[model samples]
Target: MNSSRHYVIDFDSTFTQVEALDVLGEISLENQPDKDERLQELKSLTDRGMGGELALRESLSLRLDLLKANKNHLAPLIDVLKGKISTSFVRNEAFFEENSDHIYIVSNGFKEFIVPIVKELGIKEENVFANTFVFDDEGKIIGFDKENVLSSNNGKVEQLKALDLKGDVYVIGDGYTDYEIKAAGLANKFYAFTENIERDKVTEKADHITPSLDEFLYVHKMNKAISYPKNRIKVLLLENVHPDALQIMKNEGYNVSLQTGAMDEDELAEQIKDVSVLGIRSKTQLTKKVLDNANRLIAVGAFCIGTNQIDLEECLKKGIAVFNAPYSNTRSVVELAIGEIILLMRNLPDKIAKMHEGNWDKSASHSYEVRGKKLGIVGYGNIGAQLSVMAESIGFDVYYYDLVEKLALGNATKCNSLKELLQTVDIVSLHVDGRKENKNLIGEKQFKEMKDGVIFLNLSRGHVVDIEALKNNINSGKVNGAGIDVFPSEPKTNKENFESSLKGLPNVILTPHIGGSTEEAQENIGNFVPGKIIEYINTGSTTNSVNFPNLQLPILENAHRLIHIHHNKPGIIAHINRVLAANDINIVGQHLKTNETIGYVITDIDKAYNIEVVKELKEIKDTIKFRILY
Candidate 1:
């Protein structure tokens, strides 16, 4: 085993999820007349160059010429690439950070975008051997650095030879340029990295083949565990979360079990006893008892906006992270709210019902357009603010009231109190959260304060509005029409009998809580939330965790990582270090962060210690949990 082995890795489709040139071409020629033709040409050129069928320099030149990009496009493209890194590489970023000195990004991709992306992973600029772009005075990319070795055929091989000295050189990439390193006798081994995409021609030439970076490290006995497997992790998705989420989890090689409806808490506890990852929407509750029975559960993903059904504090105490799609479904809810407002204001529900029953009576006596109507919005968050803009565009004066001071969008007005908003607006829509304080935010008094013939809507929490008060107002003709989406005591399954006080009313529209049930919204939630859960389980990242201390730790190389979660108290890190020091363990790197109630410390040390070190770490004061990952 060589401690100083040089790791020369490819960039496009190896380090990133997409080919940089293809992405740049898309961004550059977007909406242009020649976009389709130019994009296809660039993609074909990229494939040829990557598959070793064309000279690297000639292929790169033609692609660069096809890109009608400017300097301004690089920053945004870099941002996108930063997010599109191969999932395996992203989860194992700590390893690159710890071994920055021996890591080389030998790419035919340009340095302008690669520099910013790899720099975030701690890879230094000098270690990045790639071609530079020659730009015009107007910042438009005109040509490439023709003199650079990376521009020529077998450029990675030439660069590896130029470096001249090392213990050993290992090449890991998806393309043939990387395979050339081994053919030139400069690399000790060539491992095909096909986690993002596979090229059979390149794969056939490799000494070793792996789907993920973690697998390569596993083969070398350097990884703590193969978190990035080809597809063996078990996931249980309930409550009819979008099939796209299931497909994503399966695409990453996970075995999945999916169901369409919420389950009883007792049944969930029994079912999730051995589940590794559990996903649910709003109804299925992950109670403390349920979590206690989940022996192998490492992560929970909520496919909806609110995670109130999940016992987050219990999950956090048990070392489980909770993730949700808070932003993905916001627009769906807003669109539904706007549509329902229009239907309610014009008295369409009753008129449609009469026509359905074969009535010819038609009148405009109780009907009205949305223009000049006042819409009072409660809880000015994502959905509320969006609905405000659309309502205003349709000529409705929008007034919003939130406990927190929110910036008004368009000509929407901010009211001093919910009471003031109810007094002025002809329509009231609820969009509050599931916090305990908001249980009955809109009850009898609030309903009594609204103007006569006012329309009412509740697409927020089930109990946010008093259903009894709303039904009574509709009966009294004080509320002309109402659209109710959620109920405080709704049935668990769609087939179960539903009983609501607002039902059987002429102008009341009762929907089955499909406010955010659009295909686009569910698909977005399915993809976004599962990725976060996978990232947390793989990298110990708490960046977007709902109930854990957030910490972004660097990757560990040839070292053991100790992730210590404890009470937020002083001297925890010092105590942790002392215990390691007493056991003759040398610390390589450490990161510690603390919130009001919890402290998270990540310590990386040389792997020459005894098991007693872990025992001693468990004895540290205020230590809530301790585990070693190497």
Candidate 2:
């Protein structure tokens, strides 16, 4: 051992966002007859253990005994735990890796779970001083090892003292035992790590309270400070964003508030005032007046592919960067389109509906095979293109039409116009972008031209098609079956009554815009867009931005970076340098870019400058926003 300063981090609620035993009970006793009761009991046991209200062994033994689990649940439990790690830890893997020799996990959580997750961070097995599980001959969990130090009260302190550890030791945790480490002089300082949960008894006596790993790293100056306290930067994620996206923003240290569904413009406007980062799906509309209320909004993350819901021009004028995951959910949407096509062709909807109603009508009147049928795809974009390749691979003839020419994938052919595509194919699926010009692009005239009994699917914008015309076609048997994912207007919440023209119509599949609702797709989008937003926040990057001028700058190590956004007028760069020169803060290097409306500049300066320099930059004319980053 190097005999240097050490950091003993907690496992549950501190290093990870959830208590291990609680999650374990949820998974292990998932199908048990007393699931709810056992879960509550396990939670109580965890509370008592962390509060130091009971001997650690008693709590561990009791909770473990209540577990009806065997060794089989460990693998899947670890997978779930992998995603639940504290956001700070996920973002700062390098810090833990580089300082693995000095960092340790001291907790009453089981080694079976904790060891596997933290080991991925380069923490050694021997250094992890957590309780170990004892299993019976049948692999059922019996209890924990009675001799493990963490099984006893004040185990972390006892273990650290036994190690005869040298130098300053900091115990970063969220439980009473973590504080006891310092109370016993086993550690120099106790930092109450509360990225997940906070306990008052432990927090009251802590030398420092850290909400995130980045906060701790920032306070020690071991790492450069981010733009702001992540927790202080308010993020309003609307329209039921995936928990993963919310988790990512939380990981970056942003204060995040979530609304499970979309809100109306007035309610959204009311919620926009204090938000710095606003994330929404396709439904929440951000009008000019709504943008006006977002006084502190710096970025908007369109969690879906389309940005039509937001006021892009207004966001640009406000120096706010807008980002979207145009390709992240493409496969998901395409797969849904393919599945809907197959269902429609096989008359599966009617068959399933009749089956549900106890009607045994197994006739092959409307049913047909998708193979050897021509699938006309409108707007050959990400989803349409992917669907083309997959459809052709499964023996369907593919034809696509777009305003702009796109290279045909596989044996798929491109039609010159939407008319030719409609006249020729057996089925037509729309996948166009939701720009204003695309509104009513398909109406009665387009429907009139399609062959009778032609299947139709619209996975794009609701306004792109005239719903009344679609209902007419289905009524006249001009279209055999229709699958409509998007609607011109949808209810703000799940409890609201739905009103649609095609409701209760025969062979019609009217869905609530769930084209990309798969677990994999949401997870991908949740990971993709927030990373871009955080990139723009931390490194002044706008690589995938929709509104702002595109620019990306790497981290300026051991230096302060000045980010200035201004109106795209002449002499801004010169004015900025003049201000820097007057303040005697030499600019080591700078990067500048401009578009039609704004100028963005990233200047690295000597870290020795004071607040006056920052004040002068903010006072400059036409400065939309000025931030000092370290």
lDDT of each: 0.85, 0.87
lDDT of 2 by residue, 87-206 (tens): 778767767877888888888888899999998778898888888788889998888888887888878878888888788787899999889989998888999988788889888999
In model 2, the runs with Cα more than 4 Å from the true position are: 1-197, 204-224
Report the number of the highest-TM-score candidate: 2
lDDT for model 2, please. 0.87
TM-score of each: 0.65, 0.71
lDDT of 2 at 266: 88
Model 2 lowest lDDT segment of ten: 220-229
TM-score of 1: 0.65
Q: Tell me the lDDT of candidate 1.
A: 0.85
